[model samples]
Target: MQANQSRKTGVLLVNLGTPDSPEVPDVRKYLREFLMDERVIDIPFPNRWALVNLIIAPFRAPKSAKVYKELWEERGSPLKFYGEDIEKMLQAHLGDRYFVKLAMRYQNPGIPEGLAAFQKAGLSKIVVVPFFPQYASATTGSVYQKVMDVVSGWQTIPEITFTNTFFDHPKFVEHFATAARKYIAERPYDYFLFSYHGVPERQIRKGDVSGHTCQFGACCETLRADNRLCYRAQCFETTRLLARELGLKEGTYSTAFQSRLGKDPWIQPYTEDMVKKLAAEGKKNVLAFSPAFVADCLETTIEVGEEYKEVFEANGGSHWQLVESLNNSPLYVELLADLIHQRES
Candidate 1:
């Protein structure tokens, strides 16, 4: 059956997905829609389409396919695998009282399909977890929009709750920071780089809670009512707060953005630029942190571990480290459980 109509609580694990195959056509299909989302690229359609198709699709497809090759294990995309693992673990913990499923925003197992799975199961309350620690219009908000679109026609909507952002969640901080600390503990590092996927600066300003607070510096510091989820602001705040928890000194750390597409200005201190400068400044040992993600994916694996490592070493940096994402870490699973407990409470 396509779906069941039950009244049990449902938990949906949603993430930005990868193509089913590494082939250029499959990769292109994924990239076409992923990049074209006005929320993701936020550029004019013609320019965005031309840039993605003529430029990025042609050039990036083959290269990205190679990276995907590295990321593909026996289970396929690590994002999907770990997402499934998280769901299973959570289900094991929660038992038959709740239903848990995974959803990908862009590709297969989409929100609609995932929703249908729940609707088929007859779930009446659903929790949408987008797996991004920071709430961005591009990630978490987009997932919510997609879910709403799918369930709009339903005679009844589930009691939907989303754990929008978990940067400050104690379990979350413990999972990634502890993993990073363990990795860096044995090494002497000159600087720590917290790199998040970049979004256009315009998006931040456009949603600037108040007309005046989206300056990207002062606004994102303390997590005020206005800058709650400002992409740039939230990234910085997550970095700062985490750094404080980890006992990092002021100059010992910096925040930068990676995975930027096209020429439109993105919020920065770009990660690539940071790598060069750190190398130029003679910082021999550097650490890269991708706190935005709870699980490892192409962005964390190939982009930071491989691509940025090459840039740093080639520029004369002696050591570069890409910290692992919190992939099925016991604490991370515990974190998800705690979130479930909180929600159910």
Candidate 2:
């Protein structure tokens, strides 16, 4: 624990982590922590472990280390810095009534370190908010588990509560849509693409809400019941809602998935394939949005910003504009403030 000022209510901001450093060894450590999670891998332990250590870690580390180097600035990982900035901004907005600290689920400055900071602050009540906007077993559930792992050992545990999901929060969509419009004003773009992280179809079935959900195209029929926990349907619904808010036509935009890990089939319309399709169809200009992530990370920064950009350019497309992520922008800060206030109310 870093002070011991009693009466502070702690707010821990959790995000997916990054490498401890831009070097290959550190990147490998981060990858191991991230890929080793059963939720992330979603396979029998033996198979997942063998696949990761043998194939992914052996070949991908050096390449990923270079990518990490590109992302690292004077302050280090953008995920860390952005998470910290949001926490600090949210703390100021919430006033001294709370102590805010950022924690990564994997790698350096993890839950242990963040909890220690809060413990030192002498906070007895805590509210944990995972950075994932959508509730997926892999990301949100992982945070939920690790947080419990930390708080379980505490002799003086706070009244801890975990926010399950905020995908449908009005302020969340409003803030994201505002950013989208602001960036593409007067820009000539034919389509808006909302790309969310992908999980296998089987994982979707695992979280199926009774027999009626995870029905994909059919799930939209029961939007009210699924809520935020319906990862597959909600990704489409988020796109639908935001498209409506922006006064866009039905065919003006599309939603797809990115970041599939293995051979097992993930949710369809993969982003990489989607990019090629757009380019092949002679679509010259497109704008992409990744609202599933409130802050930019590897998925948003590299996959959407660069790799997909390469896809469009390679396919003879003229323009590919990525709508910047929310990060610590004013509207996003306001959205967080509203979330906290909503919780209070």
Candidate 3:
């Protein structure tokens, strides 16, 4: 049945979640849920369970907890804080015509609660936007599946539209470019590094509908129908757009992937490796960008901003700058609003 005309449309913004607290238990819980997802681990159930429970969770949680503590803010997680801010800003921009809700794919302010709010409001249509800019099975795919799983339990579900990815969206690119310009205007940099969160090479291969489509190398250098849904390709496309916007010259900018886990080969060159290479090459003044994340979190704030910065400095680099993310920026809000409007129209 169609929704009642009197009810407003609903907008749900979903992001990769964070632990409820920086404590060990909370971090463990979050990691268990996040790593256990089939889309994420991409292994058979028996193997995946053993890997997450018997190995990764037990060993990784405590160390991860420490990192979370380091990344935690006075207001709690910067990721969750930005999600809330974006929700509020989008709601204000959209006014009362729509019900805007934010949810984390894994933790508190979850999909169920967000969906329930829309259900309570008797929304006509629901637009679910995964905060991932690129379509990766581990991120956007998992979010979509979780959203569907939640809605499946409801007796009545609204017409739901999912925005899979917006990697090349002009406004989305503009938001990052604007943020980058603010940094560039303040200082000069010898090189720009676009570092995206890495996924397994197998994951990239899995995304290819045609088996032979993803061969790495020049395969991901350009975006085409064959590799449109390929996360690595989309990431490169994002870097290209931002480079164009910033007027970065050839060889001045490079792309690398970060936050690789376990021993399996993930997309490369790894961000850490890139940092050392830049340092050795005498690219002392470096500007780094993590466009994989729209909001600053442990990965962006600690890993890239702090960890990678240390790596650069230790390897003979004098200056290492991380361009801040588009957290609750007006341009970012506008981009979200525009996405919602486009879906509604």
Candidate 4:
């Protein structure tokens, strides 16, 4: 292969995905595809299939569809809309040197379509940037695997590179801090909550190359070489970096995980529990941040913003405000552009 003899490179930006519509059937189809992934459920094929088809998809789809309805804007899913905007902004920022395309890992504009654009552009090098800020087997890992599966059959495969994680990137931290500052100046918050998406404890332990090191204690307190790919550790590291940037003190802020499924144990101090605890402790006002999500999706907008707010108020808290996700923000677009340039250089 002659490397396509082109100076251009391809940037494929992938996000978790959204249902094409809020209808039950569409949500069910999306859930079936998403929950069936082995990396996500982390179970045997038969068990995973049974869980998705027989139990989860059938039961959760209608309820999840309602939530998606609440999240949908006039232009449709905020996740998809912001993703498209970010792709366009990033393309403009990178200019003629890069061909940028966006994809949703599960639904419309999937991995195959994104890679096909790169192939059509005759670009010899492709960069796969999973939208996940933290490296997780279920999210970023799955995206990388799907990208390879799509490109493996090509006669002349491009030089594909993957970004495993960028949780502690300075610009990423700065963007969140700046967003939080905008809210802080407007109102007084008694505490700050950093809520990240939850995964099973087993998932974290499974990714531990250094066996038995990812125990729920000091093991994940710092970002060490052994725990480099541990998702929980990276989430905590993100919280720490953002807290420092926002000039937050130790007791003033806390970290929690959200959106857990199944009966299995998930990474803790769960978000729901944290909200109740804060209310019980007489913390009347709190500012919540979901740094794990770059776009304002169901999790950030409905889960933390609406559902959690209700929980806090019902439990006796007066105010619960969620700091918005970095949805197509200028800083966020610049951050993505910087990452692309670094990878290309």
Candidate 5:
């Protein structure tokens, strides 16, 4: 009884890391670490190594740095700061029985550092919550594997749990819907766009252990037992939940994938193409939602909010509004607490 009462749980919240600074060198370093991951590029090690080092990192880093500079805020990258803010907030909300820590999977205050803190605190259990709403090999899966690799060396391993995916969580859906409601109330939007970070088509096929692979069609319309871990399916399910909450009609809303890299075929229709399609269809006012990310990182603030806006406007769309993410909303904190409590049971 005393042992149970004395045990303290540790919560480690992880987000995809950002460059320490939005400089060429820093961005290059960040990209090297990120793209080199097997789960991310998912190619032969020798090929992945050569591609990221020789071509992509050397050339793409400078361009990426410029964009990161645009996305940078006074305090620093919003992704990093928001994770910091949420760490303190969740710690306060959980009180003395739990210790909350923040980690970036690829950079400073990394997974190793977070786990070391839990080790020093002598925590009896650890719960990992990756910030990605939808499960993807490059994001959530990478974080899970990283945590395991680090913990495997520890002489004394504690109980560890992961909140793999929460795309269907009631609060998760409500948070996005509530954010969009504020925008909808402002004016009429001709269409609603739900954009998610794109993953390779091959990766989607790799996850289909059930043998019925992704055909990249209406198969993603609903979640099922076979495509349960499918990133595209989870993304579509997220769109459905948010649309239901906002009372958006069928024709008025659609889902697309964004941030695709390389020439390889990724899940479609691409967000950029979708924007062009909307403009061609005479949809002047569009409301875009990025539910794949829970925080307003580069993907949301810069890409979807800024870059996509450029695409829409250039293609003849008049008004484009981006529904911001649930950065530090009280409701989001509650959702995290709920996940932690669910594991505690």
Candidate 6:
């Protein structure tokens, strides 16, 4: 007990989240919580509420539940299960110096519970690692906001720190590059597509500290200080680093955004469109990467792996492969440890 007491730091690993079950009701509840967040929808409450509750969730939940059912395994959602597994694995790796807990920004094992656990442990400081490689207002930003909201009510708030973005971190880049290398060696992929989760163009602009710089074409090609926080820029930069590591030649690989929601325009070069474009150009074999998520969530496992594959094949492409996520990998655990140590220093 005394030895455990010596650990003054707590680690909270957070992911986007999943429904408690594949049932429609559970999925509906999950969607409600997720879409209702102002950071997510970024609209007036009444409008957002009506859109989510009345139109979107009501109609979309059933379809989403079907997908969740397909995604479910004997152990249930891979996203949640991996979170549980990584929590234990990371704790072991960190040893007695830290306590690690996993939380979802929405749905089961919520952020509040994770923060409460750290508070109960009486840890002097808490380090939050939002399991997103890039800095996005809807993702990492939301996690930060949720953490602050929960901890604000605590009588004695600990010295809490949050990791911003590690898009091009050596360990992170190496992990994805190594994963892609395995696929690359298996066959000759004609083109490489790095498909990151899409956020609205407005969200990117809102996140831009410099007013007019996030124009989305040439602006995103180079990662500068002004655009460092921009999601589109980071995605491009991440691709550049991964491509560099894998020695992928220019024009052979491209970056696109996937899983866009609503009517609003998302970051350009939609993955589906790119898949079609590649197929139209007679590029039969393609290897795709989703580096936005650290875990094998629905986005990675189903959307990119399955849906996009279908799109590619339908457009005359023969091979579509998704390089798996960094779920509970030793290297990823090491990366998390590095983040914690960096925050500590």
- Candidate-wise lDDT, in order: 0.82, 0.81, 0.89, 0.89, 0.91, 0.90
Please give, for residues 81-126, the per-residue lDDT of candidate 2 as tens digits: 8877887788778776677788889986788888887776767677
What TM-score does model 3 achieve against the real structure? 0.96
Superposed by TM-score, candidate 3 places the C-alpha of residue 308 at a distance from the truth, in angstroms, of: 0.8
Each prediction's TM-score against the native? 0.93, 0.93, 0.96, 0.97, 0.97, 0.98
Worst 10 residues of 4 by lDDT: 1-10
Worst 10 residues of 3 by lDDT: 1-10
**Residue pairs of candidate 6 with colliding backbone atoms:** none
Among the numbered candidates, top lDDT falls to: 5
Off by over 4 Å in 3: 1-7
- Clashing residue pairs in candidate 1, if any? 3-120, 4-120, 4-121, 4-122, 5-122, 6-122
Q: Tens-digit lDDT track for model 6 on 1-345?
A: 222686788888999999999999999999999999999999999999999999999999999999999899999999988888888888889899888888999987999988887887789999999999998888899999999998889899989999988877899988998888888888998889999999899998888776889888999889988888889999999999999999889899999998888899988999888888999999999998999988888898899999989988898889999998998788888888999999977
* Off by more than 4 A, model 2: 1-7, 209-212
Better of 1 and 6 by TM-score: 6
Q: Summarize candidate 3's per-residue lDDT along 1-345 as a digit string, tens digits.
A: 122345488888999999999999999999999999899989899999999999999999999999999988899999999989998888889877777888998989899988888887778789998999999999999988998998999899889998878777888888778878888888889999999999999998888889998888899888998888999999999999999999999999999999888899999889999999999999979989999998999999899999999999999998887888888888888888878888878
Give the clashing residue pairs of candidate 2, or none.
3-120
RMSD per candidate (Å) reads 2.1, 2.0, 2.4, 2.4, 2.5, 1.4
The segments of candidate 6 whose C-alpha lies over 4 angstroms from its true place after superposition are 1-3
lDDT of 6: 0.90
